[model samples]
Target: MGFKKDFILLTKPYYCVNILLSLSYLLAKKAPGICVYLFTPKESECELDGRETEILFFLAIVVMIRTRKTGSVTMINYLTSSFIYTKIANLILWAYADYLYGVIFGVVFIITALVIPEPTYSGPEHVTYFRTEHALDDELESDKRIVWIIAFYTVWNPACVNFAPIFSELSAEYNLKNFRFGKVDVGRFPATGKKYHVSDSSLSRQLPTIILFKNGKEFLRRPCVDVKGKLQTFFFSKDNIKAAFILNTLYKESKENGITTDEKKQK
Candidate 1:
């Protein structure tokens, strides 16, 4: 399960960076060598110490909390955050053995936070936007020959935001008459989420759930519950999704049939 995408990428990089920088004002200690080298060697304030570390660490926690309190993952976001969390955690573990690991992680985190860019996508995807539960249900039941892939998402969930571009890319790449793509923003339409058993909560493990529909019925869904009812983690990646949904096979089959611009003539 995502669990806010394994508890990372819940906060926007800018938001977290801004918080840390603003909090730096309270630090009256000396900056670490990394910080001094990056910015000012002659530091009057904004230092690093045990208590200061506590505050900054707490501040990092604040980034996570605030992002979650507000909203987590994507293929890019998921991959990036996964790497970050793994490195940071491993750094902590190795830091217990030697201090170098901690130093490296601190330097990198500080540097990355300073220069990390925020998402700036503002275009629309080439997928049908389902605005209501009734419309979704009707569309699903309306066509049996058509295969549908739907992304269940929310506005505040970073995981969804990250996957948003990938989803759009897939739709554009795999556009076909028999094969279609769609999205439902559970944030805007809570009833649709409730009807589909997907939660719109920021902490929901299935915020960016993807399901395949065929013959007016659900054929497959990612992050599905296991035999014990525990949700399984589904990594969002183009290759992963293509294989999981058998996009190549479907694409070939749909391509065999012409792209149906005139549904009337075909039906």
Candidate 2:
């Protein structure tokens, strides 16, 4: 019930402003009790104002762009808070002061956010790392055989570093304590790279390849090979990975199989 209330309150800007100001007051060694009176010259002036409407409109645009994203309440909350906070600052410094200032400030903030680093995530994870090819093989063919969505990556690849967070967040949600995520450092084990047909060289197109293993065998791999043995191009975006891997189906199968542990050793 407490979580639900807080969740609903997340969408309310008036309360958010009050809390923010109160925290700021406390930080500055001032009494926060007085901060509640902010933007409230009259006690009953608590209605959805033009400032909030403006902020919410832009917020709607941000949300719409991420419609395909599922799971990760942390991602949702961080985005909501950051965008609202930026808009609130924009409203105070420009919008409320002058009509034209508001328009310019709003656009600037949105553009700036697009380039800045997003919030850091330190949440759930169920990824397994294999040191050698032998270790990786044993786990995949183990008695408690289940789905394994493995990421074959090299440390030197910039694309793999960028994809790390996306992979971790996905594991936090869909992996569900099942060790569904596996990582193989093809940089360290080049033989493993050849075994999986992933190349680790600097100019290689398959630096960070995602493969799905099921029923103790390889099931699907992105940048899927054609019948003629040519590798097709694949975009490694989060949406593309989800769709190509059919994460939703894999997640469902994990539940149906009653996978209570990540590995046989854990059992």
Candidate 3:
């Protein structure tokens, strides 16, 4: 009875089952029996059981390859597979394959769960920025009349390291003819750091702080404070990272569009 129940459960397609079956065949000392069953009007023997077992055993290797090449399935995908496996495994009758599957499934699960990708930088989607002083001058002087959002970043700060790619993606998104994105290494330019007022005592602990300039006059700075308030005050609470990024950019845009009243108006 248990053997029949377990056999039924094994027919389901779930990652854990596939992984466990694969591991079991891999660990077996003798080759599994090459039995074939005919399942059609035409009498053709298909080695379904053996082939499936072999495919399952090789699933981890394929996963690793995919992860290296494209990327691992996201955490949610992994969890969904785990749940499907759990449901099928709960109904299994033959305890050995189920037990082995459980163990091997656990191992592969942990391995994938622990894997983390290397950090990368992705500037905004549609934005483009000039890197050199000459290019900056050229763009500013050109008929395009670009607004530059320069990412001043260092590689060292963990916060900056994490934010760099995100900033890049945002830059790319906002990249257009009227506006552009650029990045500079603050560590490479001490004079530029002084000129931008990006330093340890005040602004960001991260390497890449965002600054907006029009015709080379600084309009807005972030992760930095103006006379009004600290930049972090607008962003840090409630884990509102997306909001922070949007608000910061919007503030700059508002000033550029002449929506901002001068400090004198507020006073």
Top lDDT hit: 1
Q: Rate the local accuracy (lDDT) of all candidates.
A: 0.68, 0.64, 0.46
How does model 2 score by TM-score? 0.52
Write down the TM-score for model 3: 0.40
- List TM-score per model, in order: 0.64, 0.52, 0.40
* lDDT tens readout by residue for model 2, 1-267: 147744665555544543443233223223333323543445344344676456556655655443223121343333443444445544554456457756765665565456543434456777889997777789876744677888999876655654677788788878654437889999999988899889999877775789888777888997677899887866566687889888887788778765554555575
> Which candidate number would show the highest TM-score if scored against the true structure?
1
lDDT of 1 by residue, 1-267 (tens): 246733454376754663343433232124455445544566553344475456447646655653442223333353433334434543453354348745765676678655875555545567999986678888887777888999999976767766777788899889877789999998898898898889988678887899998787889998799999998877677778899999988888878974466773656
Winner on lDDT (1 vs 2): 1
Give the higher-lDDT candidate: 1 or 3: 1
**Which consecutive 10 residues in model 3 have the weakest lDDT in total?**
34-43
